[model samples]
Target: MFVRIVKMGFQPDKIDAFFENFEANKNQIRNFEGCLFLELYRDKNNTNQFFTYSYWEDEAALENYRKSDLFLKVWGETKVWFNQKPEAWSVDKVVSLE
Candidate 1:
């Protein structure tokens, strides 16, 4: 499995718009092929900061999503709302309890 994490910092005023965009596409993204999980998280001390956590079957699945037209539209609009450059990581589990 492959996991992807993205840490995003949004312009304070544009946070709502960012949520709207995520709400609009979250389901579609989760339902995409090879996607096994999806989640969103907010920073404890920073309301405008958020992170997306998702699991894919493999790197190719994640890459396919990145190249999809939906991604193009969503990311294009989403990046404009950022107050700082977003950070992303793709990784595989090293160990698991269960």
Candidate 2:
């Protein structure tokens, strides 16, 4: 499995809107094909900062989702609330205890 982590910084005034949007769409995202797992996290020091951590079957699977209409809609709505450009990383797991 591979992991995709996205770091997002939202505008302070738009945080609530972003939260609601994520809550509303998270289920569909989690259920998308190739998605093995999904999680959302907030930065300890900055409430406006968040991260989406997800696991996919492989690169192709990730690409499929990235190209899907669902992504287009979700990302379209989400990007407008961003205080800065989002950053993402795709990587392979090297080791895990559990």
What is the per-residue lDDT of model 1 for residues 5-74, given as tens digits with 9 covering 90 to 100? 9999999999999999999999999999989999999999998899999999998898999999989999
Compared with the true structure, what per-residue lDDT tens digits does model 2 show for residues 23-92?
A: 9999999999999999999999999999999999999999999999999999999999999989999999
Give TM-scores for every candidate, taking all chains together and pairing residue i with residue i: 0.95, 0.97
Off by over 4 Å in 2: none
Which one is best on TM-score? Answer: 2
Maximum-lDDT candidate: 2
Candidate 1 residue runs with Cα over 4 Å from true position: none
C-alpha local distance difference test of each model: 0.94, 0.95
TM accuracy, model 1: 0.95
lDDT of 1: 0.94
**Counted clashes in each candidate structure:** 0, 0
Candidate 2 scores a C-alpha RMSD against the true structure in Å of 0.6
